[model samples]
Target: MAGSLLVSLSGITARTLDGCLDLATALDERGVPLSLLVTPNAEEGHRSVSDWVRERVVQGDAVLLHGYDRRVRDEFADLPAHEARLRLIAATAALEDTGLRTNAFAAPGRRVSAGTLKALRLHGFAVYSDGSTVRDLRGDRLLRARLHGFGGRGGAGETARRNAFVLAAARLVRRGELLRIGLRGADLDRPGRWSALLDAVDTALECGVVAATYVGPAPRVTCSPRGSTLTSVPSGARLVNRP
Candidate 1:
């Protein structure tokens, strides 16, 4: 069997959401489905984007809940379970009002709390995102793909990162694991950066991994009701081979 591939674009605030949506459009044209991790409820004066998101989801694409308004902080684990769940619900509810059912949650920096995963599960989300994980909080097998390109300072340094990402991806391919590569909204601002990341995308596809449209029904296993110490998933979810 071949591995699964997941592609994500984070940081979809009001300012960058439109272009990000456009980038997603282009990817769709190429048969590469992109999931946008939208931050619901932008600060004051930001344009309301529910309509855009609604249209995206209507077209058979995914618009997963990103994070809530930057109240206490961007990460959800810092908050209590009640607060975390409520805040997460608010983000999902924003999409719900627009007739979009959210099945996944992606944190701002891929560093949300264990409570973040619980919130995602409680809110009817099956797959959890923001970082690469082989095993979800519910002990379900995840693809464990994370952003492997364009996080460097540029030039030789950036090329080094790109090569490293490709090498790491090659290793994962050999293991029959799911491949997850993340792109940021900022990546759109720099043509060179986004293009560089595309190279890594090509590397994964060439490895015979199939690009997937869905990640799943909230993990079936009962995990920690709160906090971040998640239960073990399958060997496919391990990060030992990643650089």
Candidate 2:
């Protein structure tokens, strides 16, 4: 089967409401399937973004757990499994309080560990994805997350990181591999950038690659011996870790 276009938008703090929505609206209008990997609440922004997220879900978008407040991004690795599970449960419950329910999750800033993986499987999560793989972790199957938004507007390291990912992502698609691309609501500030990304996605779709949420089993993957690098991940993979 052809791979999918697993588009996910991250960093959904209140300030990014319009930019994020603009990007999401563009994708939705194109009939692209999406996963709104959103932070449950923002400490500073309006609640409209969260409400909009809920509406998107009702309109057929998938919601994945991002984080609690997003301030604790770097600490995901240090969180004990019990605490991790509790946090996720709390976050999901909070979403439900807003009338949205989900069994999917993505990490915030740290690398998701074996402990986090186990916690996700036990806490009603059936699918998990990170910078390395979009996995049916419950079944030991690999999934694809091809493209992700990269580059911080001002940081050199962030720019380098995004560039590196762009190179890698391009290689995968060129090889006829299927993967998910990560999108960010913040990037919508420069509409041209997002427009270009959508055009690239359209190019991939015209090549006969599937352009929707990925569903089903994938290749077996193992933890990279060091760092978050996953060896042998398929081209159609999507997602990322925290820290």
Candidate 3:
């Protein structure tokens, strides 16, 4: 079997929109689907950016909920189950109102607590990525995915960091594990961060891995509700994301 690749972008506040656009242009026809991790409430003043995101969704890209507030670094990292559910509900509604409906999510830094996962299922999220793995929530199946990309923080010695990322991706591809390429929209603004993401993608393709979205090409598994499943899915139940 061939390895799968999923490319995701986050940190897409107004400040990082330009970088995100640049990276999106570069990824065109690159045989991979892109997932935009968006914060609905945070994008209130950025009408243009929101319009662009809707356009992308129409153009075949997936938009997943990133979090409620971009400034809250650990928004979903350690929330109580009830709290997570509340946030998820509010965030999902905000996205729908903005005309960007989605059923996938990726917590910041991929450091979500177990309670967060529980909330995801209750809220009818079909897929999620916690940095380490991508799970099909309803399907109760998961694929191990290691993220390789930019963090948006420009710094010295980035060449070394870029090289290390490339090397790690190559190793993961060789091992036939899922390749998760995550990038912050702000990375494009950084000196060499955009190129670093491209290099990582190129390397993975060269190693014979096929690119996909968070709704990966993995075989569909039977749906078995572990605890509580969403009693009724919201309208526009399209499943699609990354961390």
lDDT of each: 0.58, 0.62, 0.70
User: What TM-score, over all chains together, does every model reach?
Assistant: 0.72, 0.76, 0.83
Q: By TM-score, is 1 or 3 better?
A: 3
Q: Which candidate achieves the best TM-score against the true structure?
A: 3
Q: Give the TM-score of candidate 3.
A: 0.83
lDDT of 2 by residue, 1-243 (tens): 343456778877677777877777777777776777766663655367667776776666677777777767554677778878887888876676555666667777646867778788788677776775666655566643434665456444654554555555555555456556787767777545565576666665665565555322232222223313222322221222213
Compare candidates 1 and 2 on TM-score and give the better one.
2
Give the poorly placed runs of model 3, Cα more than 4 Å off: 42-44, 216-243
In candidate 3, position 111 carries an lDDT of 89
lDDT at 219, model 3: 29
TM-score-sorted candidate list, best first = 3, 2, 1
Ten contiguous residues minimizing lDDT sum, candidate 1:
233-242
